[model samples]
Target: MKTAARKTRPAFLDAKRGVGNWAEATEWLRDRGIEDIECITPDLSGVPRGKMMPSSKFTSNTSLALPSAVFRQTISGEYPEETGDFRYDPLDGDLKLVPDLSTLSAVPWESDPTAQVICDIHNTKGEPVVYTPRNVLKRVMQLYTDNGWRPVVAPEIEFYLVAQHEDPDYPLKPPRGRSGRTITGGQSYSIAGVNEFDELVDDIYDFSEKQGLEIDTLIHEEGPAQLEINLRHGDPVELADQVFMFKRTLREAALKHGIYATFMAKPMQDAAGSAMHIHQSVVDARTGKNVFSNPDGTPSEAFFHFIGGMQQLIPKALVMMAPYVNSYRRLAPGMACPVNNAWGYDNRTTAFRIPNSDSAARRVENRLPSSDANPYLALAASLGCGWLGMTNKIAPGEPSYKTVNEGTTIDLPRGLLEAVSLLESEPDFARIFGQEFIHTYAGVKRGEFETFMRVISPWEREFLLLNV
Candidate 1:
């Protein structure tokens, strides 16, 4: 996996620092003639939760508050009665939302000019709410900072564009393209297939530019109407914020065309599932050099250790990667998904892959996280695993030269509850992601799994009504 030397720092990484400060944000809104503002934050499930108000009120009101219980909510929007050993504030305490000015962007789909800004959660005492997903990422980043390392990440998200439907029980189908016909076959990397929705693709590009997001590439995936977008590599936090906002922006853009853009891990029964594959590398904070490569232009000890860390700890952190009952469906034996945490060079079959690149751009691509995962938590968990490897000098197993497919043994948790229990019991994960956060997350996911269990699926009714 050797390649020619290239520039270590790219322009997009430098451009990520745009739109910082209060004056800049105000000017951005004024320039766009923005009237409304959506002050938002990502909950445990990566869903946006916060208040919407007039732009003027948003700038004036720095005291915006949301209930602390927002972090305790499951993907289904239900709260758990018992949160393991962690007790919620009896009063359901209020938390302040402080805007991250860099995230301020225009809501391009709004008929009326509107803006959206991501916020950080803080308690009345002015301390960060540790259990919040954003803060949890920051906690992990701070660990890297302590070690004089800065992690950079690029996320490749895959999702499906399905026909608009209201019924929960109805099966999802591919949305019709500009040709006025539904996509009926897998069209991986087909230029003609991508052109079928040229108008929608144009809107996606237009909306992304308005929001200052950079898309590295776009390709048609193996599923009908399933597309993949690769984001330029940059700071982990900034990339996570972009992914969070991009999901909403994509859905809004899809709705405008009378279709639904779904980030579900497994939307259809037979189609390939969606994934959020993350490519990551760590840089020396003091020196602007990739820590994974040495001066001799070869892989460094840090590179192997990082992979070792991921291999050692990612299984314990599977709950963060595959966060739901449906998420597990995406992690099964086939359809190009990894059933185990095997590593290899240029092998898609392995969960961790060292892509063919020059020393300066050397990185590991973690293909574990589902599209439905909280980007903040997913990046944090992935990076946290690598951090442990580097610090502990953990050695990774030999890379599998042979194809590791469905016939290969599975090394990951098979279900949501199984994944949750592994995360809850791992002390190393609790040390990286806060203890209380782990407890709260486990409780919320456990509750969601229970809720899913009570439901009677169509498959069960069809098979067991008279036969069993």
Candidate 2:
């Protein structure tokens, strides 16, 4: 890969400073006649957690206050026992949510004309909250900035769109007439045969464009009713925002068309699973040069170190990458999912792949993560690993050239328990993700896993009923 000359852009040129302060935000709201605002913060599992507020109060208030204990709440809305009596006091204390003004946007698809703003959690004393996912990513970004590096990321998201059944008690409804039918056959990127879903795709594209989103491409994926959408590369924070918005937009668009969209990694037992493949690189902040470019235009040492860090931390970060119980079902070999921790050039079978492209376009593609991952956590984990590798000068092991589908000899954690155990024991994970946060996350996930284990499956009932 040959290094290409980098183009320069003025500093602060692209900064989104649409709403500078509460006063301006309020005036803007008044002009637009917007009456409601949603102050959203990403929780432990990357789900939005916050309250809807009257537009006047939301824009006029100097600072938005929330309970700090909301961070400690379980994804299912329960308090963890570890908090003991501390949780009650914290719930009563105020944690201010200062708006990230750049994130203010109107919900184009919402019928009631709502506005949204992403927030950074702060203690009542005005300091940044340590455990919040946004704060975690911000810390990681600061580390990169301190090292004179800027991370650029682009993510490819895969999801499924299914017709919403007419009745909850009835089986899934067949598509309306022959033209509006869903894909029953597993077609691997057949553009000609995918015209049946053109209406849905067109709607999605229109919706995304209306929201000022930059979606580069959309195509049919390997599974029936599965689709992949790719966004252009940008700064890590902006990329994560795009991911969050993309999921929301897809769901809203689907619902408008009388369909449902899911980002679940594996919805069907035998179907190909959805994945979120992330492409990443580092650039020099001063010169705007790509630091990952090698002298010969191949992947540079920085790039190798980044990939090495990802490989080292991947096993431990599985819980973050694939948070749900069903996420593991997509990791089987030969199914286009990564079952082993390996890297290769132009190889899709390996967990990490350097796609065959010109030096200017070279990037590492991490294929292990499912569509269910929280973008903030995923980016933080990747940055943490990269930071560690850079600081320690860790070299990556030799690349595995063997095809992953043929079952290369490398071993990966077999299940969620193994994944969680690996994460808990990783040396620097506690330092990157604070022990308190890690413990809380582990407890919540473990509870979910235990509940899943106690359930009797349909397969078990069918097999035992006749055999016994």
Candidate 3:
């Protein structure tokens, strides 16, 4: 009897030798005395979505399943269908989440020896959820990989530490610093300002170490109680994961110190807004050479084209970079934010900044993304736009020394409404970033804008309540 050939054990199912083996992760966790794990995924707004489970389950065949509608969840706990005539089914069907074994690490602040693992979403048919922010990033990264190149990124995120505000009506205020005094004025780059919050800063460093986050520097920003933390440069995906956890880590550390850590792009109108500036460069995978620079230590055509691509796409992709109504507040004139969608060497006035660096380290610093924007989506859009430039060979003209004063054709969008309108009309944007994603993103943001418009703000009550 010619029996069916015996099925050979594939390396994946074999578990003893595979890239995505969970058994190895479980063994590593047990060696470290971890008893539980927090499975997490960053949603559209960058908020973490997932649950905790016993670490022992990592070795089991079971996977985490969550409703597909979770992706459509608004910041206000409502769905798009409830507020609009969108055609998406918005079903309650479950999508399986596969844990990334590489992300398994211990949670420092937890009472239990709990670890954390970031996950990728997959549908019932075992296909990746292309619209998931992380998956979208992976898809764009694939483009680089296909071209024998890899992207490196470093994220410098600025944020605020404020006293808890119990009432939503009151504006957030800076908490008393470690010197037992509140910051009543700006303290940009003041060592004394950093010293005022020594304990909190120490906790940030300590927690960062425990979590394996390579946060190299902390400096006082222009705003009172504002600080910028820089994560060491590395792979784009790895850096995005670290930034995602770093925000939560800082928040937990802040709460333990009786302060609230906020990444809200514009927590206070009078204070300088927070920005998560991402520095990026591409390197040849085989030779480890920077594609952005020529052999003689000069910027290459690829570099200029990359910048050109970003300039054309930044306005169209502003919705992804800013992502919130308050985000536009930070992008105004005189805020030291953006003026024209111009490129310049070592100039912060332009949205795309080419920081002064040697040939090997030549990179572009995207200064537009707010602290509130999703790291994965932001990187995808930024990198994706650059890819479009490289492939299409877009030309970036002369660097404008003075962005605001420079008579340039760059038409910067002033609000979320305008940004969304611009986004909807971009032909190449929907083509590369996926039409479904662009539609979903713009639609959701539109819903948010409508909801925001319906609200009566304090300014309205104070100014137009009786006069109008």
Leading candidate by lDDT: 1
lDDT of 1 by residue, 296-361 (tens): 989999999999999989999989989999998888887679988889999999999999999999
How do all models score by TM-score?
0.95, 0.88, 0.93
Q: Across residues 1-468, which tens digit of lDDT does each residue of candidate 2 receive? A: 999989874323332223666656766666667778888888877778787888877866647777766765655566655432122343358788878877776776777767788888888888887777888788888888989988888989998776675553333322341364556646667784356667767778877765557899888787777889999999888778778877988898778777788888887666788998988878889977788897688678887888788878777887888887788878776667878778999888888898887877777888888998888888887777877777677788888787865754436676777777787889798787766567666766665676667677777888997998
Question: What is the TM-score of candidate 2?
Answer: 0.88
lDDT of 3 by residue, 320-347 (tens): 8888899988887667687567788888
Ranking by TM-score: 1, 3, 2
1 or 3, which is superior by TM-score? 1
Flag clash pairs in model 1. none
Report lDDT per candidate: 0.90, 0.76, 0.84
Q: What is the Cα-based lDDT of residue 80 in candidate 1? A: 81
Clashing pairs in 2: 1-297
Candidates in order: C-alpha RMSD to true structure: 7.1, 7.1, 6.4
Taking all chains together, the TM-score of candidate 3 against the true structure is: 0.93
True lDDT of residue 249, candidate 3: 93
- Where model 1 places Cα greater than 4 Å from the true spot, the runs are 1-18
What TM-score does candidate 1 get on C-alpha atoms?
0.95
Worst lDDT run of 10 residues, candidate 2, spans 9-18
